[model samples]
Target: MALVACLAVALPAHAVNQDDLLPAEKAFAAQVSRSGDKLQLTLDVAPGYYLYRDRIAISTTPADLAGKPVLPAAQEKADPYFGKQFIYHGKQSIVIPLAAGAPADFQLNVRLQGCAEAGVCYPPYTHKLKVSAAGGKTESKLDNWLGGAATAGKSPAGNSELAAKGWLTTLGTFLLAGLGMAFTACMYPLLPIVSSLIAGQGATLTRGRGFLLSLLYVQGLALTYTAVGVVAGLTGSLLTVWLQQPAVVLTASALMVVFALSMFDLFTIQLPNALQSRLAESSNQLSGGKALTVFLMGAMSALIVGPCVAPPLALALGYIGSTGDALLGGAALYAMALGLGLPLILIGTFGGHVLPRAGNWMKVVKSGFGVVMLGLAIWMATPFLPASLVMLLWAALLIGAAVFLGAFDTLSTASKPGARLGKALGLLLFLLGGAQLVGLLSGADNPRYPLKLIAASSAEGAASHPFQPISSIAELDAKLAEAKSAGKPLLLDFYADWCVACKEMESEVFPQPLVAAKMGQFVLLRADVTANSDAHQALLKRFGLFGPPGIILFGADGKEAQRVVGFTPAAAFASQLGQVAH
Candidate 1:
């Protein structure tokens, strides 16, 4: 089997004889290979464990033989197991491509950790795998059987091949992890606490410490959420393997209904206040170390978040199960957890002291949490809920949450601190509202083939570059100028590192040899807006975009021809290209 590999740590990679020795053997490996003409690397994953994707640090050095490994086009594959990213399981692998003139021998130093089913996590391990290649070959085999060869086909890989690469490359996106961290850190609910920490707390949290803690907390939550997403992603992945698994889809649909209903508390089983208070007292009495307590928290929190996590979770699990990158699926969970917990932890650690001297704010926070819960409900119901009806219900739920929480009454009675805090929170909410509005406006206004004409030119003997992603109007003009002069059709792909749909296109549609061949016909140009380079930003501004993965075509005359936004299948894309190129 041609197992592409990347460099891992260099600890004693011998087979484990668990019965002997103080310093146990640490197993590690990396995968490196070529896709078409590009060299790439996929980090090998140990079974029943995973390595942190974010923790992976590329060396600034280049290989002597190939020069450097080009990073793959990163994209996001839908993961039902987790809402956000891919999770990996079993022997996860990343394809590392080598550039021309890379060294024959080189090392990749990696730091990673692994965990077990029983919740027994192993210590962090390190290793380096030696990589050597004689030239680009179709059949390349790399092997270093540490835990013996993985029981072939027993455990599914977390993500599909495309998902593996897409998830990594898409890191060029506005990092939801980062955005979530900022939002949670500065949420209105936490503002009072934050101000108190800054003013009165003996040991205040510095922005650096807070940011780092936010990162760790978010990472932890993301890991946890990724575990959930892995399950969901694997389910979505199976859609391909089994044609959307109707039974599974129906089950997910039913569960989503329940999630929505529960979030709105439509089927409340009210308990007496005395009983509720006793339960709360008991919960508080239990030490944090108690597994049962944690499990209970997870279960209760999940119930409230069912509407929020399930839709994404189910999709992620299906995706992961199908694609086979459970580690990324796992990582997705960590990312989600990070999103959910970072703010809370920061508030508790740094601003816990400053929370209003009165418990009144608790009610407000609870109400805010309730609103989020309802939002989750609507989101969960969306898969089964008719889009129109879903919107109506979502609006109703929002109104109901506000009214039921007596937000107006609180607003009326709010004192200076309370009013100021509310205003700040409202500002935060306004920002979120603006973001959603922008998404709505752009989504509704986007038209297919908005660019009426496209053109291109190319050099007589320039190495045929595959289709390039274009993010700016200027780049389009430049490529058009070149194509016009050279008399070649221009192929432009507008992409962002963060788009989930873009990822789907890459993982499922772009890699087919036939698709690759057709794509190579034109003078390829890529406009990547993931990092928001000045040029890409200009294009986004011109196009009125709040998000990514817009594909456009150009004719020999160097004018925009047709554009397709979001993920397009290989056949569809090819057909479109055929029309434009001709």
Candidate 2:
């Protein structure tokens, strides 16, 4: 009884107090701005709670003096947090930028969320802030300071406004730029020289409607890019006004982590190629038929280039939203698109005559890209997670992607069905081997259990049921006590809803008949840490657990037998349980 009391509920609320929760009396001032326009508003956050990621939702409800406005892209930036751990703090401020021509007295509504450490999370919060623009020495001084960092007045003029000779030259320059960027990203910088080596055939873009149409299509790309830039400029001003210096570092690092994973395909979910092909073909067919089609093409291009838009684009959007300069926001996005797509346009026009066709070596280049991508994915997953878990995920994705790409290549070739099928399987082996190189980085399953499922199975010389969710620490202690009084072994599980591995165990290992049959020999107790249960909180403190999905075994004497921090297969868990039970 004494042992149980010390390990179980000894933790009190005052043990490791977080930040103090302020009373409702405290208030803070908020600012709203769009481009050169600015508004000062008051914001009052509830005591004991803090604003977190994606929690702030900005709206232009009261209508700025200029009119109801849409915040631009490129101006928004993510707010930062101090700790790597997933704890929420209690204070935050959001900056709003004003558009260049926004009116003097603009109004907007703000909605946010608040959280505290007492397991008492608050409901969503809302506020209506009224801001009046400043037009004096202060505005002038601020403009002078911001002129160097802002992107307003930076975009090139529209084609309609350029002289004939200048327009043609500009078009040529942009086309070449788009083509060059495309080629660079393709990673086949030397493709032109090897055009003749692929099946002894040289492909060329002939001078005709197809060529002319391609150029026209690119104009749509340019316009869309400009539109995105305007959006960026508008939001950039808003962020510039509202962004707090304290949260910047934390926000940047968290976003960087997410971006890095997305780039390396660690947790990415891409659409099927068939969907992509149909969309591209439909857009091409609709060229010049409708304005909407052109807009769709621009959207499609944005999606295609999304992977390459990373840190810079994210930062730009954050800045724009935080600020509120629609014009400047548009400029930044246009610049980015121009930088990314300029080479594609250039290659389509002048270089089509001298360029080489696609080749078999393109496959090699693709494979190399895959290797680099996989390596980065592994690196990104290494920071806060276990090496073996990262390797397993990496290995699975590599194997799956290799199989997919191999089959795609074989099917794309104009070969016999039988030959294609055979080629796919063979090429799949190559991709698999290439992908397995990541295994050199990490992933060795525990030898004793061999299942990586976190626990042992009866067949593996252990007697334990597969993983199951336990409801509370009190329930777990009761089971242990009862088991000891009856001279029986006990198995205890501590799991949470947010822990992905726990779900995996419940679905994969627990329902197995073999593990279920062996369950009758021991007293089983499940502690579910999913909700903010007081008992679960006590259990968390008892085990000094930073996170969830914990497993513990107790012998007949009611002492802690053993514990595992993460997922262990049934066989491994069973072995540990069996040892302690005997």
Q: What tens-digit string does per-residue lDDT give for candidate 2 at 263-358?
A: 444564344678767755654454342334534554556555554544334544653444344654455455556555444444544455554566
RMSD of each: 20.0, 19.0
205, model 2: CA deviation in Å?
Answer: 24
- Model 1 ranges off by over 4 Å: 1-254, 264-324, 332-582
Q: Write the per-residue lDDT of candidate 1 for residues 1-582, one digit (tens) a residue.
A: 001111111122112222221110222344444444344555444443334443344441343333333322122322321232223444444444455555554554334443332112233334344444543322112221122332222243442444445655423221353233233212342343223223332354465555444343334334446566566445543443352334544555555555445434455323456855664565455444223343344333333333334433443344344444555656655554555554555554455553334444434543443465455444434444443454455445544544443344444453666565656555554444443334333332111111111101122122244555565676677778888999877776656544445555554456644556666667877767666556665675454433345565777777778766555666777687778776
lDDT of candidates 1 onward, in order: 0.44, 0.44
Cα RMSD of predicted structure 1:
20.0
TM-score of each: 0.30, 0.34
TM-score computed on alpha carbons, candidate 1:
0.30
